[model samples]
Target: MIERSVRGEAVWIRLDRPAKMNALHLDGWRELYGELDRASEEARVAVITGTEEAFCAGDDIETLDAMESADDVSELAVELRRVLFGIEELPVPVIAAVNGLAYGGGCEIVAASDLAVAVEDATFALPETRIGAYPPYAVERMAELVGKKRSMELALTGEPIDAETALEWGLVNRVVPRSELTDAVSAFVDDVVRSPKESIRLTKRHALAGKPSTGDEDRIAGALARASLSEECRDATQTFLEGGGSEEE
Candidate 1:
């Protein structure tokens, strides 16, 4: 579910499940957290990207639909927070190298990363509402990055914005042609690692200090559990899995 390698002063983590457009299940999320943990120990910078035409499509709808109890939903929410918060608390900067679509939880990952670079063809959205669900982590993170109004526009509308629009909204740092993506990411990595490692760590810590807290995971998990078990979500998910509804976000 994840591929990790050390490239010079950076560690590159790639999502490897192209068959599902790299959508993550529980095991995949756990694997990602392990990679991030390893990156903190091994590299000065970390870059996350996906294979082929996808960066990540987000959590697997099948997994979400199969969540049978409040405990399952709560565990999912807790694990999601661990990964997202792990990115923030890591000693080195984490860069999301977006190659294609980023939707739902995928978009939340972009928002949580310290910085991001994207191919010109990449797209982003918080389309959970279309499935009668919502992204637990993205609400506060998107509001922090793009403000409440714009964030609401995304979460409520379930529409995708282009790479250029993401840049304009402050979700990504740079957008380049697909061919230039590797070089673009390498350039950022080089610039970041040139600074002393401790300084970089301290800078990230100080920067995060200014951000508003989103409270505890319990509240977030409860909201998701309620939504996931709702009649609307169950009906929407069933329709989607049967291929009779819109594409899974």
Candidate 2:
């Protein structure tokens, strides 16, 4: 589940499903979209974090396995795209306070955020390829932050990168001790809110002005649908479900 709270001028959103490593299902995505909407209206800055030890493991594996067709996959992709794009289009800056592991879609969330702060022990990865699926948003947008070579390395290898490495690659702005993660994020929020809200909003708007159009969302979603419905994806997901591999979730 996604939880939201107000803290003066900032809104805090927590990914709260430790048992599944904070993996989100469709309802979670919808709730997150609603929370982002609320944040846009009510706060000058927003922060996304995780409860317990995980930032988010990714989309729930069981939910992915349950999809019976490409349309089912496409539906979930569209819903996810709404939240990811919503993060990008939000009037105020969004900060990802990554507390622990951020894998697959979770990493995508970090990429989409305006800024990110991660704990020293936090790990990030786009391991979707291991299960025969792919990270739609990460593939398309991560290069803007981390460069094409780094992004390709992540998506192609399906390997996890530590917080220090993530910072070096420009995936996150700061890396602090676990105990200091909240304070670090608070400091960033303070810095952001120090500016006039309209100035901050306009700065973000102008920064995004010449960015590539995301009209390829549908095309990307279609590719994801094909990947998710392939026999390779089904077989790999089943193997993982049957204890053939070990991961955060």
Candidate 3:
């Protein structure tokens, strides 16, 4: 589900599960974490992208259904959070090249990255609440990026915002035509790499230093575990996998 390649100092990690709109399963997340860890060792920067049609759709619902208990679900959530935190803690910059639909965890990936560039038509949303789950990491970081009210609106309503709206909300650094996305991201990467590596890392560290702590990860994890065990969420997830209902419904 991940395709890795190296060009110059950049390690590109592509999510390649087009059959599932690039949604990640548990194995996929583990693979991604391993890839990112390797990138931190060997590369000066990492760029994550999706296949031609999607950046990512989100977590694989089928895998979620396979979890036998809330602890199983908690383990999954904690591991995913660890991977995201790994990306954030990487000494080098991690850029997200969002090409298409970035929903749920997909959106969270962009939010977690140091920088992001998106295609004009790409859509972003945090739709976990629609399935009776909440993205705890997203809830923790999004408010700092987009302010509390906007974050609340996005999380509570589970509505998608377009690329323009995403930019306005500070979710993406740049939005370009689909054909120009590669060039745009490349230019951005070029600009980032031109600066002194240590200075850039220090700058990133300082910029992220003010991110507030909520002390709610464990609480949110428990809630997600509980939600996963809910009959409503189970039914909603099955329906979602079957392509039966909108998040709003």
Q: Tens digit of lDDT per residue, candidate 2, span 153-210? A: 9999998999999999999999999999989999999999999988988888888799
Q: Cα lDDT for residue 198, model 2? A: 89
Q: On residues 70-132, what C-alpha lDDT tens digit does candidate 1 reach at each position? A: 899898888888888778889999999999989887888899999899999999988888778
For all candidates in order, the CA lDDT equals: 0.88, 0.88, 0.83
In candidate 3, what are the lDDT values of residues 1-249, reduced to their tens digit?
899999888899999988788988878888888888898788888999999779988788777877879788877777678677666777889999999999888888899899999999999998887777887777888887799999999899998999999999999999999999888888878888898889877987877687665434477668888998899988878878688542221
Instruction: For candidate 3, list the clashing residue pairs, or say none.
Output: none
Segments in model 2 whose C-alpha atoms lie over 4 Å from true places: 244-249
List TM-score per model, in order. 0.96, 0.96, 0.93
Candidate 1 ranges with C-alpha deviation above 4 Å: 244-249
Show the lowest summed lDDT stretch of 10 residues, model 3: 240-249
Task: Report RMSD (Å) for each prediction in the order shown.
Answer: 1.3, 1.4, 2.2
Model 2 error, position 152 (Å): 0.7
